[model samples]
Target: MRPDSAVSVPDMPAIDLQDVSKTYGSVVALDQVSLRVEAGEWLAVMGPSGSGKTTLVNLAGCLDTPSSGSVWVDGVDVSSFSRRELARFRAEKIGFIFQQFHLVPYLTALENILLAQYFHSLADAAEAMAALERVGMAHRARHLPGQLSGGEQQRVSIARALINDPAIILADEPTGNLDERNEEAVMELLRAAHQAGKTLVMVTHDPTIARYADRRIQLHHGRITDISIFSEDDEREFDQILSKLWTLRENHEPLHDDSLRIAGPLSVGRAIAAMTARGWLCRENGRITLLPPGEKRASDLIRRHRLTELLFSHTFELRNEAELEDQAFKFEHSLSPEATARICAFLGHPRACPHGSPIPQGDCCPAAS
Candidate 1:
């Protein structure tokens, strides 16, 4: 069947995994998983580490076979195909964007775009040019990947992914390495691609990033914990809980049943129940503590909030204390990790927030000089 044949009457899922499971020896990567992605839709996969997000993507992309059960793509059982046939499916029907920006250092931007075509069909320079033009990178077609900045290289990678005009795009943390502006640049391209009818599957840890998709699924220990089509109200509630947890962390206080209830509708009990279920909180002795994953999430939120304060105070020349606080609240949610890192790097990794609390060191911070 043609790749585009995935178009259905809104009832048939584009990709389906029925009772699928994958194991690496004793490690269960995906446990009897089943999922569906509709044609021309965008789906976001989210989970904490070791939650089987990557395994699902690999199986769907035909990069790895499930240990048991079955894998289907575009309504075809992919596990039935031989190795060569699977490779052909990937070449003809899938495009990929990786967080690592996997580009050939020796190839020019134009050459990289043409590389995808060489595998699936003849390499056409005009076709490659059009791909680059779509990504606003036509002028730098002759430049090698190494010659470009992080964002520029990522843009070129986006061009390469589009060269095939694939029906599906699989992106694993596509904005992972990009710093602020570049992350947005790449996401814009992805957003455009989804709008143009490709089925998109992306894995990201950020709720903000996941919000860009039409639906999101959360996984844990190889099981789907929650699947949400997402309403702003739900995201707002989650963000509220995250912020409240950060405040408790800052105070060095163990959260109790009394501590939650940051925003609308979610009661303190419901919040703790939800957070505990997600492995974000542990309740013992009537107090709650954040796990490693929770700490990381809370830390990132704190960084964004404070970094926004820094930007408004200095970059935007805002001086009113109250006004800056309001601005920071508005700016915090949309800031990506890359953007936060850039701000931290640019600010020389300041040790304190505007409130005099110490800022946590992010990966982008230069080693102490």
Candidate 2:
């Protein structure tokens, strides 16, 4: 929805910061920051705590103005807007999703969404309910924020953010308070919004979460230190190598330098050395073993692989062992933890795959007996 409050200037970026700096007395939050968020682009801002990630999002959302230079949103110079104008402009053009799930304590789920609609334009009950339904939260429309689970509350917050049909969605650590399943649910909604042409500027501390964006920027002491664009081939190679190591460990087989099984099309020796350098695994006394962090990552990947096997077996009724293994290998890396959980739940949380191998328990699985 185009906001009437701000006139669109031709050839201007969707969200732009020109040499912006923000300070609080003796402390500097952002220094000489210049950023441009293109229309329909997803940009991730990543940094450690006290690294000015939040400050950058706040400026883009128009929640706070820059101490120097200018901040512009939707081609308008928001830095020059009056307080009332800024509020109106933000309401119409920007939607915010906070990590804290900032729903009003006293308001019910539906009511909270209506509040956002009230701010943006006329509050229509039908539209608000539709928004909740989109996020699969319509059944709990009457529940208050206090009565909902963390995931439920976040879903309600998402509904509220989209109620206005804003062009830009600013999210700050949106999945910070969620578990694996809930985080997947929240990301699915955000991905849908991005697909619908909403520009997303999200601040995150998790590398996995940051990978969802088109580009990622790292902040250090209020300065943009690095920018990264992802390559799919790099990720695929890493997953393939890790999976081979995981299989060896799970089968109680030693990963000796002469283990030809692990040496596939890729240079297995170099891959193992790289993983060891990254602290994902260790090579000692001519044997290789996974470190704690690497074990967990490999476990998740294996879980996804077995779950995919189960899904394919049931859906396609395929009984060929080679076919199932081939399909599972190709599809496993594409499944998110959340999607794997759903597949597991759909299959009644089976403990074993079609080949009778025990499936690894995911976070969404019930406790083992």
Candidate 3:
């Protein structure tokens, strides 16, 4: 898609690559690639080991710059930003989550998170606590990085990232060092943050994990080679959820909070509360209603969530429903409405979710455009 044609054109993209090309002598690290990611979207950059994934992340995170073309973040073309401006932008709007869990061994988790605040004018203990709480790491706030497990350390890293309240998070192989269980745990935290409206971009070789992204773009020879949308599994899952919602709607059955799972890091109750506060919904007893009576918003949320899970399962070849379901739940909510719609369309308007239920239509997907 043309950069200008992206949804909400004037809105500063969380990250934008315009004909960006990187080369070292005869070796092309990336070639004239263009892409746009809106605020609050999770995009996975995937490719073989040397496919320029890290190069792209470095450029987007402001750690480096493109050899050609332009890179924009939050609407500012940062290709020519002064050194001070680059440092300020990186501190204010971008957070990096490294695979190595680069926490100070001696500092407590709280202190590590607080370290990021030193660059800013406002710093408070409450903000630190809230960041910890957001990552389910509040209980471990006082623990040193050495005392925590790999997963726990990653969580601390995430909490640190949150202290900045950045619009975009750049993670590089965040789960690479952990075992299966730990990997899942770290991913859960990342997913949850994404759902809460943070913009996230991660580099991973694992397709399963990549599936958690609203859009997966592959880089080869330093150029974008493919962009994968939602797949069959995604459609199946959407159909299942839609069926359930429709059943409840038709029977006039109270839409029990327990019956609906938002497929996000936050619980259904939390999701409902947030959406209601934003005027997206209204709830009375067991029944929840879309406040504006618009199907599009609801569909957008559902489709994004389902497609995220589907991508995880398909990319990773994960066959366990419980595993896939857990991953999907956190991923879906991390997507922007525009990215969500693209995923839904890519999946061919799947009638059911992976678990076998109808997928509800949303405003994001217009009727036969």
Candidate 4:
């Protein structure tokens, strides 16, 4: 479907924002912004306080409407949804996670997750148990939120978000309440969920945590400042290309101009031309196919892209999706292959770009090592 037509219908963007704006009297919480997040994408929203990160998420999750512009979840525009429509939309399409666990004080982990299902139907204990199991928290399912550690409570919260099989999960600092170790643990769970094809968008101040996203978006003073899928550096050029390819594998869409920023101006035509000149590309069914060195080269590029995205997302505390991608693109092509590989190892072989694409495999990925 055309991008424009999809805006009004029940579309499937884990989250979609189109020239969306929100204002409170004289204060603008969000300026005009347009973004689209596909299914299974994990997008991190970053910014300093009052940058409109929360406002954007609220708009996407149906908690708030844009003062002007449009908000769509899974293709359905909810800008003017009625109270019942809003409630139903939230119940069927969105799952929310906050810094605070928000578990009912009197409820066990199992009960907490089950309570979420009650909105749609009667609470189902068995379903709740399965949800807990998915988060690796089944053993603690009977434990009350207060009895669990911050990380554990967060896990229960995540399970609750999943109880209804939501199309998108909106996480606002899911790791904020935990220490370093617990934060890592919670991030691991989130990573697993992303790998399993859940669409996730998170708002976070912690750059390190944000690196776990498929894409990082930075918001500045109520406007999108930048977006990134990788980091910058000479050695990372190939990795950026590979990363883009992995992300676009299923769609075959041409890389966007913004994406080109990651690895310099080397266009797909240029990359293919260069590779073909070197006997690395073979045409197959009007599409380019990699052979031998082609795959290796692609893998190297992906490694660099992933590493760059990781580093910049951490360094700048970027949450705005566009800014993060721009930063990664600027420096990703300069990293040495060895350095890029090391960074990838440090980051635990991320499977997709911040926008949720599989990371191409070659000498730079974990298995390659």
Error of 1 at 219 (Å): 3.7
For residues 25-128, what per-residue lDDT tens digits would candidate 1 score against the true structure?
Answer: 99999999999899888999999879999999999999988889888887789977778989999888788898888999999999998888899888999989
Q: Who wins the TM-score comparison? A: 2
Q: Write the per-residue lDDT of candidate 3 for residues 71-189, one digit (tens) a residue.
A: 99878799887778788889977888999999999989988888787775456788888888887899999999989988889988988876776778999999888876678878888
lDDT of 3: 0.75
Q: What TM value does model 1 have?
A: 0.74
lDDT of each: 0.82, 0.84, 0.75, 0.74
Instruction: Output the lDDT of residue 311, model 3.
Output: 68
TM-score, predicted candidate 2 vs. hidden true structure: 0.75
Error of 2 at 6 (Å): 13
Which regions of candidate 4 are displaced past 4 Å?
Answer: 1-12, 231-369
Instruction: Give one clash count per candidate, in the order shown.
Output: 1, 0, 31, 58
For model 2, the stretches where C-alpha displacement exceeds 4 angstroms are 1-11, 241-295, 302-328, 334-361, 364-369
